[model samples]
Target: MSNTTRSKPNKPDARAKLLDAAFSLIRAKGYCATSVDDLCREAGVTKGAFFHHFKSKEELGVAAANHWSEMTGIFFATAPYHDHQDPLERVLGYLDFRRAILQGEVREFTCLVGTMVQETYDTAPAIRAACEASISGHAAKIEADIAEALARAGMKPDWSAKSLALHSQAVLQGAFILAKANGGAEIAGESIDHLKRYICLLFNRS
Candidate 1:
């Protein structure tokens, strides 16, 4: 006989459900509009489960930021950096990934940290600090990539990797903002094109 019963409420990972719900809602509806009830409803979990995992919505936001950082870090880890023999091509490949994101093929250009940074950077010190730290960590990773490219080319960097990384992050973040503001991908793609030119100018490679 076939028996059918309702699935367990605490099925799968409750914390993962909560995080997924929070990330989706925040991405879809923005951070300010997402609430505990919204997350619980979206995750099909109970309030007890939500509160059991996260003490507050702000805590969940921080957790979501960390999750995003981890997920994207993994993406960059295996991205097409080694696809081309030229070190400059590797750098260009990295920037091209950013362009794809702007084009909304793999992931939207919307960055969780960038979203939060725009809203609370000046007013909310804790949230701003979290965003700042995440951005800094990402910048460091890009710096390492830039250093690798320089080393592979047998050329010493006139500028520090950290500075180049910071610039790259700034350009990418700005492109995201323009994309969101313009309500289209044109601005983002164009901005990145300019950024690509800037990168070529800096490295003296095209």
Candidate 2:
């Protein structure tokens, strides 16, 4: 009888795989409920592999938030919204882009850092800090455009650019919660539209 040889399983990129698994599981089950075992099982890796990369679950949470930030930073930086010549148009386009991307499952479109912070802000300081950095870092990108648009319009606003920037994130995180509760994107889309309308009114954009 001819001997049949089985193919060896491919080795996964343990760190990246663990991060991906954590991002997905945390988004679905919340940070506290998703254990290291769950992440390892989802990642198809061993406990040794998980611990080799991350010393503790908290360490993994921090890394996951940073990974999400880096990934989304690249995604938005290369997005078409940046092509607009007018800063206000760019800002509006960014909102429109965000609304447009809300087509998939709630977990697919929702913010990882936003979800994580809401659950762990009080209990997990390191993870909360990571989440804050990711959210604030993203807000800073839009804040620059807002500042430019304000300067171009020669308008002095009552609110600082930083507040408005953070406000946008607040709206988005709230919208995600509504979408999750309502079990659809309709309410979330409406909320984003309202945000768009408010921004338009603020900038006096017709």
Candidate 3:
């Protein structure tokens, strides 16, 4: 036998390819419209490979949401916003970070889980629940900083950190929809701008 290099195929590699394809295709086409065939085509994997990894398309959706959460969790954890010593500054810095990241195509900048949940909320309960977990999980991260900011500021207001954090996600998901409908990123940026302002006003910052 000739000495030659060959790659050892791994199940995770194929599963990851399918999940990555789902992230892109679902963002572009939404959940109901992005069929399994499209995922296979985009992922450059066979139907057998697809089915070998995922029991069904819905199962893939659930995995995609979880994977998206994992990927983004790391992305935000090490972000520059966390560098600020002051908790409130960190919160504002998080807003700035969000605004700075709106510098790509609509699908590229938008949330994959958000894109999926909108269309699947009623028709696909599993996907919807997975999406809710992903969104709420990310919001929980923000809520931690917000809660710290609230405690440090000694602000005893009616509103809660959890609510504000989830509201931030709502604005972002809605901004993505506006970006899709208007066929540009400007609207999304403007929406983030407004969100930033709202947060600043909430904390009584100029």
Candidate 4:
């Protein structure tokens, strides 16, 4: 074998860095507040490199939203949902995960979709649509998990899975908003605990 190894191309490296930087910055700041210059700086790449990878900031925002959705969807799907035998326990575990994420204090209290919705919904329709789509996708994943729990318990719901899914999204997103407004994660967790109770009641009723 030759002593020298082949070097990876710069294009993929630049693209990955840009995406990672966009993800971090958008999560820290809202999409509208994060400029292309900021993204380039965060990525440690020049504006020319950033433009080479993403034609426009809107395009980069959409890609970041997609990346966020894919990553978080996998996390929620595999997280301790089936740990308990009872459906109610499983539901509470999901809520507990959300609470832990809130209280961890390592990450900022920002959901990509929520950030985009608040920042770019009126200005950028495509970016807004991407965020909305990501929200719906998360809801669907949660709904499927809930449906699985219902099946395991030999129970059925009067409402469709989609309704339950949307409700879950609303609860969590509302909790985030409350946390932001209240200047702490405690209020958000408390508000979400009520949602936990609601889910338990729903599970018992089914």
lDDT per residue, candidate 4, 4-81, as tens digits? 111224665877788777766776676778899998898899999988988999998888788777667666666776
Leading candidate by lDDT = 2
lDDT of 1 by residue, 1-206 (tens): 00011122465687888776755566556778777899999989999998899888888888877776776666666777657666567678878876765544212446777777777677667777877888899888777778877787677766887888898889878877776677877787788788889888877875
Better of 1 and 4 by lDDT: 4
Candidate 2 residue lDDT tens string, 91-188: 99999988988876777788889989998899889999999999999999999999999999998978988899999999999999999999878899
Instruction: Give Cα distance to truth, residue 134, candidate 1, Å.
Output: 2.1
Instruction: State each model's CA lDDT, in order.
Output: 0.72, 0.87, 0.84, 0.74
Candidate 2 stretches greater than 4 Å from native: 1-12
Q: Per-residue lDDT of 28-86 in model 3, one digit per residue for the tens?
A: 78888989999999989999999999999999999988888877877788889898998
| Residue 7 Cα positional deviation in candidate 4, in Å, after optimal superposition | 21
Q: Write the number of the candidate with greater TM-score, choosing between 2 and 4.
A: 2
CA shift of 194, model 3, Å: 1.1
Candidate 1 TM-score, C-alpha based: 0.83
Residue pairs of candidate 2 with colliding backbone atoms: none
Name the best candidate (by TM-score).
Answer: 2
Q: Sort all candidates by TM-score, best to worst.
A: 2, 3, 1, 4
